[model samples]
Target chain A: MTDLLRFRTDAAHEEPAVSLDAFVEGQANASAVRLEAGDDARVLIPYLDRIMLVEIGFPKFRDGRGYSSARILREAGYTGELRAAGDVLVDQIDFMRRCGFDAFAPDAPIDEAVLTRSLERYDYHYQPAADAIVPVWKLRHG
Target chain B: MYKYDQYDQSIVDARVDEFRDQARRRLAGEITEDQFKPLRLKNGLYLQLHAYMLRVAIPYGTLDSRQMRKLAYIARTYDRGYGHFTTRQNIQYNWIKLEEAPDILADLATVEMHAIQTSGESIRNVSSDQYAGASADEIADPRPWAELIRQATTFHPEFSYLPRKFKIAVIASAEDRAAMRLHDIGLRLVANDAGDLGFEVYVGGGMGRTPFIAPLIRAFLPVDHLFSYCEAVLRVWNRTARRDNIHKQRVKILVHQMGAEAFAAAVEAEWQEILPNKSDVPRAEFDRIAAYFTPPAFEAGDREPDRADPDFAVWLDQNVKPHKHPGYAIVNISLKPIGGIPGDASADQIDLMADLAERHSFDELRVTHAQNIVLPHVRKADLYTIWQALVDAGLAESNLDLISDIIACPGLDYCSLANARSIPVAQKIATRFAGRQRDLGELKLKISGCINACGHHHAGHIGILGVDKKGTENYQLLLGGSGAEDASLGKITGPGFSEDGIVDAIERVTDQYIAVRQDGERFLDTYRRVGMDGFKEAIYG
Candidate 1:
């Protein structure tokens, strides 16, 4: 767990979310659940009120469904931890963060220094997304 | 041209720094090649057969003189002394090294250009007609809208990681010069009965191995609601478009599989939720972007015809197109210099063209989908002078839409994906038809070294596709395709040819076209009337 390059500022302090098998087995007591990349986020939307964490699977870095899943859950008013697990890498951390991925559990170890630099790569972004960073367009016109 | 403000400039500048760091990581082995591939591709870097090719975005086919000069500078410094303008109205440098890509991007940022999303499985550079603002038949300039869409989709979180790459083209004229019907999302800016501008949205159109003329999704959408509607379509695609199969993943396939009605229903349902309390672009933002694209000041005057030389007359007839302004002309500078590669322009030629653009075309120019450059707002009186300069520089080849003007992809010569060499095939064909170009009359000969159709062979009137057979390069010929207003896919004729044999086949096809006496029909028109049988027999029989 310590080897993972977590993008969220408070990722180290947070408890790990339950995997899909664990969640399914302990459905009544689970506070957090991990979902595979293919799992429809819409199904989890109804349960989002009580879920403290919603860990989405990446499966592969090139498979971008997790990004959409995180955005969907965030848009559906899920304030829980949206962790990107499996195959997450240093290069994807910033984009993952923008799409509401607050925690990461990469399958492989990442250089902490490289991950940190990648996260702070840009001060501004052009598109308005799940992140708090003000879009360049809003900064310009306002 | 849309001048980048502090924010826009900062985004591009920051991207350069980011890419520089990513390159460092890749070089240091912090990331594997598999990890670095998509990262570099998203930044418009490709590892080709010869070297890393860097594609720079020429947003909506428009660039100022400063940007043009910077492109020339990039060509001179980071790459070989030349760059290729692509069919998507973007430029690609074929001789880039991985180490120098960041520096090239940083240099491009100074001129408010970038390689961002130029080559990736994301929203590509939004293309419009090269003659977008200058064309006489336009209802309204589509540049502003194209710019708006470009800005919105630049780093869109949800869309950045879609199943496949998406392309959007906008056209305002009745004539679809941008090939609007052949995009993932084609927005035709049309006026309603009240004369207010709206979009005739077409979706799912594309060309690859599977070509589709995008069907009309929403016949007319109010201008203000465009962003939300577009988001709905993309949202539907992201969630539902096939991710399991890479080849069956474009929105076109989904549209076909789900049926247009069902797809429209899904989009409508999504749009309903998004319409209220939406993240759609506001009117104020639209106005702000639109202000940048306001027409340049032109002294209103009558058409003044100058005494033109015979060569100038030939060029005028071939390259010059109608402009909205009375005394202005849209000049297409042919990149297809006879027997040369179709779209390659040397650094010196680029610089000279930049100088010409500054002097005669209001300091701005456009890159056409046909791999030509446009001085979009050239005054009619200055045509002769521009023509003379172009002729002197060897840029003036009076073969626009003629037989010698071929559109070819960087096939086995550069592209790692290619099975054969398209440039040499194009070169030989152009040379074969060099003397008889004008007489051959308005034949679009497009060549792609593979089925990816990078050269858009599917849209060429006389299309040549390269293939691999038993470790040998083979060329397949197709006819009667078009990318213009009346969009149609070309049909392949029987059998493939060796490289020289293909050129000979093309010669025989043209010979047959000349033999069939039609009063004044163009090559495409004659082909459309005669069908593939006549051309097939002429080539194969």
Candidate 2:
């Protein structure tokens, strides 16, 4: 077991064991789906409710398709584990978490202390994301 | 000026603490240099040629007297005793140290300012017209929307790791002082036939090796839906922009390869999906932001305008801009001293300008996209006093929009990416045209040390691009470009020239314009009327 830190508040109590079964695209009966940087996230929307974890690949640190993929999966009502695998960095922890990513499988070892501190860097942000913290504008007016 | 509320205050304070930690980690050898590069860049710290350059945002070119004084303090204490105001409406210190970066940011946070997003592949500071609120010809003040956009785009989650850096420019006047047509996303506040305020949206306009004017994507979009529509556009760009090549990753390349019509269609499709509930700026939120921009109080003024001193009259003719109010005038402080760098100001000059702003222009000043400063609401009666003070301090150069007022990037001297030296060339040209600028009349000379076009070379009446040809510095000359309401790209005329040869070539081109020009034709007009052949013949024949 990879001592993974699950970030999704709503999905924390779910079962942690998820077999990495390969689900080829356009195949009908695979259990879970995987996405590359070039693949469209909408192709997995129909199977989101049934999928256990949707693994998105970040081939390079600068390629940001995983962030969009994670947001799209959550927007399509996926409550399962959305794991960001490959080439993830410690600095992108908060961004990945706010974009609806629950678990990370970075290519390098992540310092848990730095990761925790990074996620708590700003309690509030200017834009509304998947995180539940109120945007600063709402806090100001409300 | 927009004052920071409690929420704004807390956000900036938290960011300062966060960057402090990040800088600590980077210096402690915890994170690798590759991992820490983007982190520092997002906070506007760049590893340049000599040292780290810190670019602090001015937030739509508007700053208060206290903020200006703080900037002066930072310049005096942190780095050297000067700062450079860039063409992007931000100020840069070229000699910041890595260790003191956190303290500098913490000090900036006291005044609700930060270096955040001034660099990196994120949405940077949203710029607007420097004369936004005070211009007589404006339809409405555009700074409110600029502020709102800045708030919305700051640290946006999805677009943070963008394919390339993004920029947005907003303008309300028919005159294009802000160079709106040359930004990634340009918003013009326009009125429809029904007399409702709306935005005319333009996308993919940029200047680099490949220069292009933005194409209009939406003729008119309702003002209430501005944020949602912008979200839709950025979302579309974020999802589909080219990621294979860093050079081809800007939204401009997407717009070019996919065609504007196809890009617009894609954005519309994304917008249709996003508009239902993803993004919307509530009426209360809009009003709350707009409240900060309500016009300042004005008293009844004397009907007669002062026209007494000849020196003051000359300054008025060159530097004073028309105000929306009759008795008030907008004063533009020229940063382009004769044979000097375009926008470098010393610590004392910064403090003096701050004091001048507090006393003469309602405690606020604006930085123009052309790298000049503006005291937006100066009374006509105080013009003489202000002019005298400016003259004493060496800030009173009477060359607004003149040939000597050049826009130049900090080229080979400081920038790690420069191909040739731009400052020396600019100095040479300015000195060459010092006494002849008034006669030259309304000529904009722009210089870029490389093809990145930071000085907006493509938009100048005369554009000079410095290139390294076979281990020697060579320059290419272009003519007939304007960043005004009638925006057009300049055309290159034949071959390149050496540094001295290029200056002489420019003079030759101008001399031809002077000889064959009809009554009262500006350089651009005469070039447009006579076309490129006349200048080509003058230079080569």
Candidate 3:
């Protein structure tokens, strides 16, 4: 099992990290927190310092609380490495980056070239995130 | 309608791909049905009585011709050549296959649409008046605010797991066409003393087994604080709303138990704690969002009365309504025939409407909760031609406020929760009262599939509720229910009737109202004065 999942964005001054295992059973968490294990917010904020890797827990990718959580963590001052862990597929990597995740860890082994191509599927930036990337709204407004 | 920027498009595209992968996993036995049910529902896919049903969101009931055409395409290709426009202003394709749903969702994503939050115990589609931006009496267009609210509420971490589903409706006009009074949160845009827009917010109002008109929580809330205030309300509801009993889980029941004043006080306390937070909508952001909804450049025309064309005059009296613009009229496209289903529109009809909207109405069309469509911004000069086209398309019946223009839910035919069939009841009532529409005047008929009251029968002037009597279908009639400014639940008159006898019983009540009404009074007014006694006798006797 991969112990660390790294998430780095262009906006980060240095690499920042989080650990999925420490996030799973934290003392500051409540029952609702455990129920929402796939949520990044639960582990993202508390485990920001000592961790260098974060997992995108897709109990099921259809349950997209993880995507929003990943975005939230990235927005809330996390910058290191992000990995899509369980149920992660080749198609979701492009969006994962737009939402602020940087690394892809598909359930099955993925070819690096194919994964890179997936990241290049869309050439435009749209959503605002920790990456400080120029968004489509800025282009339109400017 | 607000066009989706690339951000919106990307999110929808990503979501579609995600659902497609999820569907593959389900097929591969990677996820159980229990695990996949909520997942599918969050994407607006439902496993109904027989097959999967896909509900496509029509945000705030505002759709342009292009979106409508896409919906038409979906109906023709993926569905049974027809779609049902729901009370929440979304369209549902009931006969959808589980395997085909992913492709359908992909098709929808291409149009910058998705079914996210249309179901599940989270914020459902935010609905507003179909005549939202186009209504003449509106203080301001409410769609931008609705859109802002939609964004604020969509997948908010704290709100995704609420006690029950939440519904919010915003209406800017004095006449509450969106039935704001029956929503979980009803926002009425109001102008303050300085002629600036604010909201008169109502909370805890909903219809189901126990119907309650939302009580006024805040008479006037600053427009800038809309998001924060809503956040406060939801937070309070999440913490206190009942979760033990599914029947009493709605915020309405909680409000009823605690009383509206106490509920409002609790919400106020919560709001006080969060007043200085980032959730407070910044003035700049409000202005930015509101800019998208600025009315199109409407040339000022003569306010002087022209000699009314006889046909145009009749159409105006029955269908066209006053617009805030001097020369423009808000036109209703009647979905009801003399005897037809309340909200079902064929693929062909949908296509024709798209064409008509593009040609005559600034490329905008609105699907009302009343199961009718509105070409909300038609000019007076073009009204005659538009009316002719609508008539040619078999859509012009001039029954805007008539008895046949009923609100009926997809009862037992579609919904698993229904106790009895409501469509046939609505059809029978419409047919029975077709000849007497002119005499019936402004009667509002609302029918519910079951006591859940999706049809909003409880709030209708003539409310029909379908009930199951030991295994047989029976119907109950309720009188004097109004979903207007002075909204009230209808009072059940007497005994429930067999399905066959119910329409005649309604006809008898209508005949009674006609005979005893004092000079052009509506059925509701007359029912209020004489009470249910006279109507009960007329129906039962």
lDDT of each: 0.86, 0.86, 0.77
Task: Report the C-alpha displacement of residue B321, candidate 3, in angstroms.
Answer: 1.1
B1-541 per-residue lDDT for model 3 (tens digits): 6777666777677667667867887898876786577668877888777778888888898888988999999999998899988888888999999899889888888777788889977788999977777766777788988987876666454466566888999999888888898999999999989987889989988889998999998999989889878877876776666556778878888888999899999889878855644455456655677787788777788453343667556666898887777788888888888778888889999999998889878888898888788887777777778877878888888788788998898898888889999888878878777877877889998888799998998998988899999999999989988888778889998889888788888889889998999986888999999999878789988
TM-score of 2: 0.97
TM-score of each: 0.96, 0.97, 0.82
Model 3 interface RMSD over true interface Cα atoms: 7.0
Which stretches in model 1 have alpha-carbon errors above 4 Å? A1-30
Judge candidate 3 at residue B486 and give its lDDT: 79
Collision pairs in model 3: A5-A53, A6-A81, A6-A82, A7-A80, A7-A81, A7-A82, A8-A80, A16-A79, A17-A51, B136-B324
Supply DockQ values for each candidate.
0.59, 0.61, 0.08
Chain B TM-score by candidate, in order shown: 0.98, 0.98, 0.96
Provide fnat values for all models in the order shown.
0.60, 0.54, 0.01
Candidate 3 CAPRI level: incorrect
Question: How well does model 2 score by local distance difference test?
Answer: 0.86
Best TM-score goes to which candidate? Answer: 2
Model 1 interface CAPRI class: medium
